[model samples]
Target: MSIVQRFSKIFFYLALFPAVIVLCAWQGWAWWSWATAPPAPKSSTGETSDADKTVQIRIPPGSTSKQIGSYLESAGLIRSSNAWDLWVRWLNTQNKGVFKAGTYELSPTQSLKEIAEQISQGSVVQISFTIPEGRNLKQMAAYFESQGFFPAQDFLAATKQIPRDKFPWLPSGLPHLEGFLYPDTYQIASGGITPKAVIDIMLKRFEQVALPMYQKNPQQIKLNLLQWVTLASIVEKEAVIPAERPRIAGVFTQRLQKGMKLEADPTVEYGLNIQQTVDQPLTFKQVKTPSPYNTYLNRGLPPTPIASPGKASLQATLNPEKTDYLFFVARYDGTHVFSRTLAEHQAAVAAIRKQRVQQNQGAIPQPN
Candidate 1:
């Protein structure tokens, strides 16, 4: 009797235990679903999701989460400002405040989680600008304005204030920073860098690249920083062909040594009215005109450089091509013909003039 009673009691307890386990599992599943479920359709604020359009938002420096949320809502990046704020705050609490300040690009289709991640990662707007070599401060300022980097007046004024002493390679007391702004494409924020800051960065880069080259040359050939820069500037303006730069430099150096007139066309062009084009053929009158910058009339280098030079021109000036050539004239083709003797130079000039006359005569319309 005792064995049967014990067996029945044990069987009853085992069945009861299974029922209790199933009930607990069901309750736990319900709790899990409630806790891990997606957010409600409408947040605490009365707002609906409009996930159809994309928008860009600028979260400026020192902006709070609430301010950023309002900006996002105003930009149409999200439908609910309050919902975005709450989500961002939740992230701040969870991730220990890792969000960064920037102008963020967001789409309405993005979930709060995705937008939050992008903002925290400092995703922002960017722009590209190109500063071409040999551009004067005025020209560079115009370029900055055209690219929306800064206002023209602001840049111009800032450029005027840049201390010439900061760049010893530039002639002292010049009107503005010249021959120091290195030219290259730069990625910058829209309206982010100050004009002075931009100029300073470029000049720094120029010094970094050019200083070593200046240091290595012999003292006679190695001019002081300013003279080297001047020579480089002349070399830059003299030849459009990369291969011709060293040869052009050689001719200038020869003239400098012999106390001869440089007679460089670029210097003549610089002396002419601003309307003159670099590519236009020079008239004999233009060459003979007396100006402070006219290398033909003057025996030494010009008062100042005509343009900013690039690395290649700088290098060519430092290490010129060794040749006996003292005169060079542009040939019928794009290249130049060099000569060592005055007679040879005269003959070359005559040949070039004859070719031009023949070409012009051939192009003239004959009477019917």
Candidate 2:
């Protein structure tokens, strides 16, 4: 070993040692900083508006950790995919929770660990929507479309293919799920927001809330399930005021008992796919139009329920207000004028028409 050769080798070894230490230190610092730093940093005003805003990210089933990390990085939820990989490796060593597939509401302000924990625990976001009472299938379909849930016709088609296997109590040969879909606010995981899923959930809710009402049959209304729902649907459309629901149901019941025509305008509108606006009402020709749903022409309940009635309307139909009144007319103020005879009904109709004419400069109203 010559002195020059040995010294040169020692120097080379010393230089390499410092370089390795500096490189290791730089890598460690980078790992720590990335683990702690948020994707969206705070502004000079100390407000993290962008960081606070949540983004919806869906993790498909069977995605690997690498794929998930890349997804998070692309979504701007994580500072770096490499840092996420390191964190995942550490988590794997600890045998922590497994990542589950779902729709997540993630924010940029969340740390890598926080986001990872949320996804691992399957903390999925749930989306909710409300179906107001008196909305028929077509209206409901349009509503679903407006909310970007599904196409309108898609929902309409789903309604036709009734899920009878799961719900055996549904009346056989139902043309469509018009009256049975109980209306209410429903919350479901975002990943499961499909047409069939919505319909099944709504049907299940109907089974839970309304089916029992008929099963108990406290009032023992002679009407079958289909008949009860049909009558309640009529009451729902005609009676705007909550208090008038029972009275309206009573009128329908009396007319049914006497075998007279129901003469409900809503039925004609439903059949014709038209709405009776304040300026334009059902015409004489429209009323005389032959349709199965035209209660003005048909002598019984409509073929199917015109709309989905609420629990209150269903209860009102079952235990209607016992009255001798056989007819009623809407005053356009969420109130009705009840009549027991043809003359009284005609007079009340005349009074409403006269009031409309006075309000609108002698404009005549369409005949009932």
Candidate 3:
């Protein structure tokens, strides 16, 4: 209790004050961590229900770690992009969260670790339905029905009710959703895939496939989305040879620029709605059909696409071969003879008719 002893004791308490404060702060932090830390992710049997929260998130090809993390975050499958990035860096996962790009079935309840592993594996299971090129919406619908998938009527209804507001690139006053359903193989990623979702998927794929071209040079293609797809559908229906797509695209492009009637036979056939095709010559009356879809009667491109053009046809329409040839007549052998002059086109048509006559004769040979 002497002055020297009291002063020494005060100095000792002051020295210990900072340590006491540090210990108290550490203890508080530990209590908060224990109180607020996320519970351990419950194990799932990997079975997905038809919950609205669960969705198929597509990790675009070649997406960086940050890009993928952002997508998952937006989809509500991850907490946040920054958290995902930090976690991925900590795990040093396969490619460090630069996951394999594909459509993945994801749920909010899944642990970040489980999601990362599934994506790194890159397994897109389920069925893939291939929509072939040059098939009209009705034909496409029929194919869907034939496969015992969605009913044809339901498929058609979805096409009729495309959420165009969701797709800004899709122009207004489209003839119908005929040509926009991009022709490709799409996997049914989930058990709850509905008809409307299927339509959205096709258009989304089209956007993924074609939006970059338009975005790169919006003015390069002189037509809007509807017009471009319309012309491409015609070219898709006309071009039989794989190599002839560009040439066909060129023919349509030049004709559109010159203000000439397309004179495309497919347009006339579509106008007539004649389903039974028996490899016979069209009657002269069929050429003069009075329908909006008939390019022969109408002066410009059809109001809507006649069929779904494949990616090649769409690309060809956007970037044509840029030729002077204005006309083409289909030969019997899935090829066409190109011509710039009317007389040349007529001669090509005549040659095809003669070839067909010879083929018919050969089929019915005279017994000698």
Best by the TM-score measure: 2
Every candidate's lDDT:
0.73, 0.89, 0.78
Instruction: After superposing candidate 1 on the true structure, give the runs of residues whose Cα lies further than 4 Å from its correct spot.
Output: 1-71, 74-76, 84-123, 164-174, 271-279, 283-291, 364-368
Which is the winner by lDDT between candidate 2 and candidate 3? 2
Error of 2 at 172 (Å): 0.9
The pairs that clash in candidate 2 are none
Each prediction's RMSD over C-alphas, in Å, is 10.6, 4.6, 13.3
What are the per-residue Cα lDDT tens digits for candidate 1 across 1-368? 69999999999999899899999999976754433232233334445455443455666678888887777667756566766666667777888656676556667656556777878876666656777666556677787888666798998798667565676655566665556677677666532567877877777877788777787665446466767777788788767788999999998888888878888877777667443442467887888888987888888777666667888988899888888899998876668889999999999989998888888899899999
Reference-based lDDT, residue 189, model 2:
80
Ranking by lDDT: 2, 3, 1
Better of 2 and 3 by TM-score: 2
Better of 1 and 3 by TM-score: 1
- lDDT at position 30, candidate 3: 71
**TM-score for each of the candidates:** 0.69, 0.84, 0.64
lDDT of 3 by residue, 1-368 (tens): 99999999999999999999999999976754433232234346555444325568877667887888888877767665666676678767435544676678777767666677778777554667889888898898898888766799998878877577898778776635888888889987544356887888888988988667655643434987778888988999889898999898898888888999998989888888774243775677888868998888889998888989887888888888879999998887788999999999999889888888888899996999
- Between candidates 1 and 2, the one scoring higher on lDDT is 2
Worst 10 residues of 2 by lDDT: 41-50
Q: Report the Cα lDDT for residue 77, model 3.
A: 75
Candidate 2, residues 161-231, lDDT tens digits: the string is 97889999899999899998889999988767788999899999989998888878566358888999999
